[model samples]
Target: MKIRFLFILCISVFQFISAQTLSPNAQVSILTIGPGSSLNDAFGHNIFRVKDPLNNIDIAYDYGRFPFNEPGFYLNFARGKLNYSIGKSNYRDVRDFYKWQDRTIKEQILNISAEEKQAIFNYLKNNYKPENREYLYDFFYDNCATKIKDVLESTLKGKIAFHEPVAFEQKSFRTLIQDNLDYNSWGSVGIDIALGSVIDKTATPEEHMFLPEYIHSFFGIATHGHSKKQLIDNENTLYEQQNLKTHNSFLTSPLMVFFLIAIIILFVTYKDYKNQKRSKYLDVILFFVTGMIGVFLLLLWFATDHTATAQNYNLLWAFPLNIVLIWKLKAQKPWVIKYLKFLVIMMCLLIFHWVVGIQMFAYALIPLFVTMIIRYIFLIQYFQRSNSR
Candidate 1:
């Protein structure tokens, strides 16, 4: 009986040993597919195995525009859903932005004028409100960081244990920055919404304040096994060359808040006037026009703040409801109006944003241009004819 048990135990141990453990500095293997000789022969394989950044060759399996620090964990292991980068220039800008941070964000921010430093400190004091910063960071990290870690730990457990601390080195690492509405101190706060901001280590990592710092730190951990501080200072020159500053990116974030309020009033008043007149024809056309505008705002929200971070913009359903109110202008086809309203409600539950950010705002020009062409050709001609007569 003892001999039989020993043989069984040995067999179980052998079975366990056969499962390979990935090395601490091993490449991050991501699967892809290629054309097969026959339809049945097609298969997915680990095609893009990311090289360790610390290696002499320094190969980057670029994650491109996806926001998370750990590409492997964010793109593959977590949910199998992918946020693919569509534009090459767009992807390169984002990549270069982070690479700049990984290279020299530390000393760069330190070189700011005292006025800028004081301004940031003052802004943090007024805005973050102590616990709010950490609370928000933890909130974001809970969704963005912790989930990725769980996937990594869970997927690699028993197969590979993390021997090195899963944190970035603090020495060579610096906070990467970009121009966003919320953190726009670099530009005049009065205008040009996409002004830039970087994390100030002088303060406790605060949401909006500290979050950028952790982003740079986490990105280093994700890309290079080295901690944030461990990255080589010499790499920063390559980073500097990549970031060619041109005309600054702009956004109208402040005006948008006020714009929403004014439009709501305009919509309500117009509907009320039409209700008394029972203008069925005008109401019908207005519904389609307003719905298009609402969808336009949502597209900007998604493009700017990113999908994972777009909870605030999700509440922008008010834009579509304006269409329903246009229908309530007391038309015979109230059913069509009600249907449009319902559709608007459903979309509101769908769109989301991180609340504080910038957008192409110009992306609005797409729908705007289309609608304007129809209006100018018709309305402008009608006005000219009336005046001529």
Candidate 2:
């Protein structure tokens, strides 16, 4: 009985040691998931897959998980104070889940030494701990996709060199985002409206890794800093997204909807000009809606921690003071005329900004801009004439 007990104890220690380390057959790969239908998933995702057949380990670790049920989740998200956590799951489960979602899954087996692979695996395991898992999420600088590149750089200690892919053309962050979204979609419009000129600057080649597709492309062409060998040993498309018919109704699109609203505004202004009267209700609604949007953008720029929301030029048109002065639209005070003239000047400045490429406004807002300019001019003349009388 003593001999048997000693033998079992030795076996348990060997098993524990094996579990703590990776075998020679261990492999680390990056899994790039294709974009989904929603705006949140428009840029796709990245996961680290560590597999060790000898150790019976295959786990997919991702840094995109957030607690939706956490208190103040939505408020924190809005305030840019949300904490994203590392999540681990069986590799097969993640693959099957993305497959079921009809998203393409591409795997790039990293070309690295066994030691480097072990370091990466150990780092991920350590990061998965409850206290270490949570990190401040940044949309551009720190996100699910960028984490893949960050992990490799941190673990390998400058061993990986990302080369610019062939035929690479640099683009601004906003342009890159719009590339993944339909131009006239509401998602695109909202992004253009809320985000400011900070995203209009050209992003560096390395900065492009913020998107998962770029991470895959750049990683495929990366090289080992020391040996200069290809960083990716093999590339495999584990799941190909099915070609599904996507139906987008043009009639309901932002461009079409905004165009219709602009036409109505122009028609009302024309009637007001002919009859020598103003539509106070229409003016009130326009001011209230635009003012509210301006206030929200202001909050995003000043009140939040989002780096991309700074210096937003959308305020040129959606002036927040309009909300405060909306009640005085019909007043014949000279100040009202001055305010209308200021709005007209702001519209011109908006056009100049768009023309000079200082910022790119939503294409859907073009007609609205024109209509707003016309209405503002009309109001300026009408107010001046009223005050003179």
Candidate 3:
């Protein structure tokens, strides 16, 4: 009786271990979630899903999870030192969560062999471990979307090939980013101002996978590098975003708001010109605001680890020296007049940069730029007349 009981216990233990392991029939797929309304969700999301019907196991692994409550979270984020971690959860729960957010979800079932599938599953499991989960996140290079392409290549021993899709038009990183955002939206304007010329370079076909939609597109047409076999076996739309009417008022748009501010600045300058006077307070405000913006941009370029904020040409117009010269706006010094002339020259340089495609500035700033140039020219003339007196 004792020998029979031991034999049964050993059999039960072996069965449990086998059941916990991924079966030969397991499926590994990429889940692409459509963009949401908010700026953070504007780029959409991507996740890896592993499903084993034989083992009754379904799990979703995501690389976008960041611990918001961790120490120095906001500071590290600002400095680009924040670490993002992989999170694993029940596949059904993840699907339901994004569905509740009214985002569309699509799944691309990979055509790789069972061995490759098991390898990817094991890779994700090991990556999900607490000591191994965290990785440095880079927006254009090491993001959630890019990880889907990277992980497959890494785990599959570089057997995957991403071919250029049909009628693919190459675009700069900035253009690709702005494609998902409204042209005149505040978010778009902020991106244009905060990021710099580094993003203006044309991205490679594989680099385009930084966006989740591109990941889905590239992976759909991908194939095994060695055998030239199609990579995707099947594709399915799990959920579709509901058609909802979104209202954006023109009055609140960045273009309209900046236009109105330009009109006000021009009106004040015209009045000052007619009276043969300088608006001391107006000069003070413009100098302070533009100077502060220049300082901030300098910080983003030099003080942070952000790759996109380098080589910003926006500093041509927003000169930081203006902050120190605010008190000297009314001075009869000859150097003050020369400084005003220098500002006008900088404005012309900014226009040259835009024309040459060295960098793309915000289109909504056209009105503001025109008025600012006029204002700087007026300051130069006004200061000259004051110095002569």
Candidate 4:
């Protein structure tokens, strides 16, 4: 019984195929399944598609040979191949006044034999295997997603569907996907080149760091210092004449702030000591306070100039020092408060550095700001816990 059904189905398909004439010249509109299969009718016009044999995918449909004269077929028909094919097509639909261009098409047709021309037409008409047809769609969707986007646009009218084939074999479908053969490669290449140019033009003074984003957003380089560390040797003769003087000036400017903060902290501790008398020993406070100063010194060193590469890395040593110091001062409370006050002052200076002249600051303030924030959080947590206790 199953065999009988299969035979009937084959017979029915052959009848349908026979009903369809080889007019490759008939009304060029697409019929969903591809140049050959009719899926459904819309707007009383059929949408065409080419089927994928391997993936069960059906690409968008095209109408027909575009009357074989537009820029698309303009070349083949003008070269006489299309004209000859049209003459060969039994479809009575061939227009009487059809013409081809001289430059793109007419000359090429003279070179091919009639037999070869027929073979070409036959291939376009019948022999385009489902696998090869699969390639066209893959070429568009995978490699030329952009072009596929352009052609699938609505403005071309419904007649463009017939240009597609239906049902390609599995191997052909995958082959097209693997091979990227289209306009995207060029587009990406152009973008990369443009980005390289930006990197060349706008590298930072301290970094001279190559950045690709500079191409897309030219101004990004201006505010681009998310984090940066610059290293420049001060061993040169210019160091003694310039950087040495600059370093000395930086060392002194923060002196007033340091003294003022220290005095206020000492006053607070003295008041606490008087309230509790000998019960409030200064050991804990002194230990914690010294740790804060050590941290502040590192920040000061980094903020002195834009080029602080080694200063930043060497600053990492401060961590182990911090762990040891905190353990030693574990019992200190008053000292911790005084140190917290010192950190608050440094935080203010960090912001000022960002605003005054990041370029002159060489943007060293970024890390200083981060360190101050983390330290500030620790101070806040300690105060909150102490107040509750």
In TM-score terms, candidate 4 sits at 0.19
Q: List, in order, the clash count of every candidate structure.
A: 17, 0, 0, 28
Tens-place lDDT per residue, model 4, 29-128, is: 1121101111111011112222222323223232222243446454442232231111122211121111111111000001122332233333434423
- Please, what is the TM-score per model? 0.29, 0.97, 0.96, 0.19
- CA shift of 42, model 1, Å: 37
Highest-scoring model, TM-score: 2
| Cα RMSDs, all models | 17.8, 1.2, 1.8, 27.3
Q: What is the C-alpha lDDT of each candidate?
A: 0.32, 0.93, 0.91, 0.29
lDDT of 1 at 322: 54
User: Per-residue alpha-carbon lDDT of model 1 for 29-124, expressed as tens digits?
Assistant: 221222122211111111112222333221222112343565564434233243422112222353454454442222111122233223322332
Instruction: Estimate the overall C-alpha local distance difference test score of candidate 4.
Output: 0.29
Candidate 1 runs further than 4 Å off: 1-58, 65-80, 83-235, 239-244, 248-321, 331-389
Residue 215 displacement (Å), model 2: 0.6
Order the candidates by TM-score, highest first. 2, 3, 1, 4
- Model 1 weakest 10-residue run by lDDT: 39-48
What is candidate 2's lDDT per residue for 1-389, written digit by digit as tens? 99999999999999999988999999999999999988999899999999999999999999999989999999999999999989999999999999888999999999998999989988998999988999999999999988998899999997888889999999999999999999989999999999999999999999999999999999999999998999999999999999763857999999999999999999999999999988999899999999999999999999999999999999999999989778887755668888888998999999899999999999999999999999999988887777778
Give lDDT tens digits, candidate 3, residues 251-306.
99999999999999999999999999888888899999999999999998999999
